[model samples]
Target: MALSFLSHCLIGLCALSLFAWAEKECRYLPGDSGWPSIDDWSGLNDTVQGRLIATIPQASVCNSLPYGNYNSTACAELRASWTEAETYVTRPAEMMNPYYQNQSCDPFVTEKPCELGNYAVYSVNVTGQEDVLAAIRFAKEKNVRLVIKSTGHDYNGKSTGKGALSLWMHSLKTLQIIQAYESDTYSGPAVKIGPGIIAGEAYEALANVGYRIVGGECASVALAGGYTSGGGHSMLNTAYGMAADGALEWEIVTAQGEYLVATPQENADLYWALSGGGGGTYGVVLSMTTKIHPDGFISSGALQFTLAGAPNESSFWEAVRLFFEQMPSLVSDRNSLQLEIENNTFDVFGITLPDQNISAVQPLVAPYLEELTRLNISYTFTTNFSATYLDYFASIMGPLPYGPYPPTEIWNNRLVPRSVVLNSTANNLLIDAFKLAVADGTFLVGCNGINVADNEQRKHPDNAVFPAWRDAIASCSLTAFWDFDAALEVNLAVKETLVSVYTPAIEAATPGSGVYLNEIDPWYEGDWKQEMYGVNYHRLLDIKHKYDPDSLFYGHFAVGSDEFTVDGSGRLCKI
Candidate 1:
């Protein structure tokens, strides 16, 4: 009788496993029985006013195996223009990071057959709020995976998904300036910008009106989308605050297909979450209204130097250490620095000082210059002044390069707290970690001395920006790139070094600190929730559930993404 009972228990366990497998839930994919039929797609296209598009990989134009449109001349032009930011700007499925696309249609891989791989299967050209609503309702009704894209400038593959329906929001370019916008906690001039407005366009438009707003340093980053939602840092961050800090209201379409305005007073939770909680989580944003500051004369500085020889290696690090030490004082003076260290070269692209003159910058750099001279290091330094932020941006920031050709690059970032910079022992550890990190990839650092925690009026307590930013003196990113046609192991090895070696080194030096969500490693093996949102993750998750209970909008590493897993076939399935 006992043997019979044991056999019965084993049989029941096997039956339960089969039942679980049979009950697994996954979003519909092409070729699946549940996938929308051609008629269903045609109906959705009509609903969206014929803006629904069957996605063809942007690089397909260069490949004969994929869509058979290959022409040698066109392929050459496509390869030439591939690295330009504008190449992917208007393309519905193109993304900055091609690793997520599974190299399906890489322009450079002519030996392999080009396939759609992981690019969205379909997309809706979002021209208006109605389009956004139509896409949302269609995806929900059909149980199709949905994703959002604006400018395609995302770093962690948030804008693109495999076998999904994408809402391409690049054409909604509306910009309206409110000269005297009034709100509950503030009253000021604000600009209402469409989700499609890139940083450069917004800067130029605001400058034309004799005003400026905190925006991304990258010219192609969309102002109202993931940039702001990720707590965007800017050259003006030290002077004002983060990009999210300037936001006053958001016009969005919810998962339930309702159009609503989220502000400090109404849909308050949604407003707070959308402000800094990662984008593509809560709702589809249509436009964002943000506070604008009067345009003023801006002063900037640039410096560059290289390791003269092997003998100067120690001195080079010493100079970098000295520069890191001065970060606190620079922040105290409302100055921002963008520095890059790579291949034995150090470049300070710009030190932005708004509403000030070159004279004000001279004093701040005197100590660093003195150290460099003492170390017998040669360097180049220059300073300039501009009448408006746009002029300053044009001269100092310039257009950023778009790619590591087929887009095989990854970044890992950490926020260096003020305490770490102030502590001598900790500072040396941080510098040593920088050395180890730069050995594998480029090390980029942004030092902004703004204390958002102190500026309670500008950054509300409820805002979802990682709390670490409040105490951070600098932000550091270690980026690794590989050849476009490199083997899978090569890419995996690079990711391993970043995740296992560099990330831990930085974290050890700055314990309890968090990373910038916008720039973190997508394959990070750490406590991402704590690292990205800190103590705010719980609240953000709660809000995410409240607004999107079914988790319709999914992005890698976004809030509430843990509930689903991408299966072998690239289908998003509940875990």
Candidate 2:
């Protein structure tokens, strides 16, 4: 805080302190003191009175992130806050929340791995918007950086900034149906949503009214940030485009401590930017008004494929080929499909509106199915009906946790096309890697989703987001789950194996293929700037100028890039 502000309000606080038996969370060093210094633990007693500290020590989650002296100073100052509070951990355990806390920390020291490179949160979980505002204001006044997190699903750990305060937004979820179009008002219905609502809540709310919105595939992903920030694709994308297209307006809290609204008509730049700009670019979103579709039950199903037990053996690779060829035929906006490959099985998912059917979809997808059958691939199809978005999202995306803590670990990811199966040459390469990775337990999880096409304003000139891929099909996500200590080696191994398997094929099949920034991989050998945003990068920079002229909202994925840092090797630097 400013000297004047500190002298005025914090003098008493500096003299007071709090003591609590050590919890896993307390072990985490705070990012900034929010005060100049502290004399003893008793000084902070009042601040942590009701707060429950964890008994276990948190594990470190990230392996590599640019770190330097600035980080050291931040941690040192933050630790001083507890010193003034006279707080000490009497019983040091291993960790806190399983979903949010790092599961793998070194046993010797309670200090977070932030010293290595990664955010070790100060305090998290504010009561509400007011609490949120207070935290932001205090951080700014204190010259402390911050990271905003709702569900903490960010693979890069961007949800938590190193040596900073994390404003956990999960409790902020409040879904209100502001306006349900009257009988005479329109051809469609729409509703207002809170910034914290998840895809499951909004989906069910709208679906109950007899309509649906293209929302998150994961039931637990936050609707406003996680879902809309990336072009939301689901079994519905073939029908509704993406979650952002349904959005009409947005309420955001910018970095400068100002609350503002962005819409297609007002603050158009910001509205466009958030649609698919990829998360963490501009400001924390408060709420959004999105259009809802006509209501009806949806029929979704899964088709399981198995290789012909050629004397107890079916060529899993050939079975996969037949599945890819089947993709083009199944492009109905009413239908969505995903193929998951694991060592044990090949799971084919097919979801469509109730009115659409397996029989109706057969012709569209028949050719590929025929190829699979020709290979003696055995298959079975199963499905059911759902009247609510919750039911549908649950059936489709399944339940990925939206957690209580800002993420403690770093997980890397990539987005790729089905070009791996486009031809014989590529197929051969992909099949080999798939077999090896699965056998070695390297390719743990593989999931795919459809992308919205260009027709629904996806090509809006103002938005420099998702690169345009005409008639684009799907994005395969290669991911790994590991502890902080194991994260570095595991994440890298999965990434390298995935790239090694596909890069050659992607190059041979679709040279200069576009990339999706939302599914970014730092090492992917593609034109990142061009493939990620296309021509939108320039216009977005321009738009960022208008909406956030002073660049107060620069920490997240803001528009302008020039102001950020760079190192001697020509690598862009991170704060």
Candidate 3:
């Protein structure tokens, strides 16, 4: 009897030990005993039909010693193309922000050793749902960190992860136009875009069918991924609606590795969360079908002025004040304006007015133009009319330089409520905040009066897009940049200035407002859950727990991300 009891105690102790070992907080990392073996990865590659690729730092071709693929000619070509947005989008594991890349492999730094610092160690070139499923399952079973990437145009470093297995959705280029998509709530032309389809490709494809869709102004942004998932805004937002407002259905693979179609009538909660809650959080999006509009002419106007052209500093500010004052009226006319303010320079890249003639903008900008003339400020203004929205977009806002120019750039933005623009006191305060931001860094402001609240009926009433956006008249972004070789402290100071000084100033101007999730400061100091998702955050959290209870899908500042933290070694661990 004594021997039997001792044996039972030993067995129980062993069972407890195994249980404790299985519940380790951190995910398996390379060189860890629990990490997937060669045979395991080989099986996954076979499952994905040999699409698995060992990650090579994009700049590896520029380095000589570490990666060994270096060639002087290829390095030169890479250095030239590094500034182009297309260069990063085509390469798996290449992100727009080099800051997240940890300056591991810089094309310009040939002497430095190229390493896969924060980039994924391996990636599955996802071709379809099967590939996504295989990768998700493998990561779940192996307890490895997994991340998803599409076009790699993320501003907040959500697409790239350190020591992670990546699902590179860039290859899933499937595009189909629905001539007449009919549903209980929506009846219109729609487009089914694969997760990989970028804005430029979608625009061209839709234009060929004499239609257009509301997508990101930056042509390289993937239409189906983070762009739409984080409440995509476009030049056509005032006339139509935000990208989330057009989402009719989403075909996604949840964290449970179950394939599901989420629409208003079925899996409605999933649909709402996936619409604007955030991307790379709730599930892996396979494709999205969004409403498309008929092709229509767009009138574009451009304006430019510098301090040298102004009578005085005071006069220049007055002109800027007048421009902000006129925003409401212009937005009421269904116009969208993209403004860039740096030091003493103010450039209106374009004021896009859909379905209007070039003459339509004359009255809209008369007040600001008159103010410029009254101040004796010399300015240049031009207007052009395009045959279609696609024509105007392609001409003005096609692929531009992304990053690694200044090397690192961070952004913090606010959705300026319409009420603030209408109130004189608030408007001046808002402009003061803008001036302060410009005094510190750069501000790329998008002015529009989109009625997302009214337009919600076009798709569904409830979605996860921040409620503040529904009442916003403009989106103001504060940007800061640093050199590639800048020290960590310098980068932190730049981000801290935006967080402490600029963000608070803007937030004070637009009280109770929120920021665009897709283009937010990664280290936002405010209540990020509220700022990004607003009143819908709790509901979104519930949905997140329902779908991804294990917290398998984690991105920086993404929903449910608060539950986990990435340690110094970059292993994601439950807090």
TM-score, every prediction: 0.93, 0.71, 0.92
Question: Which regions in candidate 3 have their CA more than 4 angstroms from the true location?
Answer: 1-23, 110-112, 399-408, 440-460, 485-489
**lDDT winner among the candidates?**
3
Ranking by lDDT: 3, 1, 2
Candidate 1 residue-wise lDDT, 1-575, digit = tens? 99999999999999987765643478877887678899999999999989988987767777777578878887888877776677887688787775675567877777787787778888899999889888888888888889999987777788887778999998989999999999788788999999888888888888888998898767877889998999998888877778887888999988888889999899999999988999889989999999899999988788888887324789998888888877787666557888887758788877888899879887878788888888888899888889998888877556432212233357778889988878888999988888887763344433434445455334443688788888888777776664565765677677787788778988999998988898877778778888898788898999988888888888888998889888888888887
What's the C-alpha lDDT at position 411 in model 1?
Answer: 77
Model 1 misplacement above 4 A: 1-24, 309-311, 400-408, 440-461
Model 3 lDDT tens row, 1-575: 99999999999999988765754667888887788999999999999889999988778888886767988888888877676777878888888785686667888666788988788889999988888889888988898889999987776778888778999998888998888999888888999998888888888888888998998777788889999989988887877778987899999999898899999899999999988888999999989999999998998889999889998888887777778777777776467888877768888888888888888888778877888888899999998989988788877775332212232457778898888878889988998888887873344444443545464323335678888887888887777664555665777777788889888998998998888988887778989888888788889889999999888898888988889888888778888
Higher-lDDT candidate of 2 and 3: 3
TM-score of 2: 0.71
Clashing pairs in 3: none
lDDT, each prediction: 0.81, 0.52, 0.82
- The lDDT, on a scale of 0 to 1, for candidate 3 is 0.82
Evaluation by TM-score, superior candidate among 2 and 3: 3
**Residues 144-178, candidate 2, lDDT per residue (tens digit)?**
44566665555434554434455556555676664
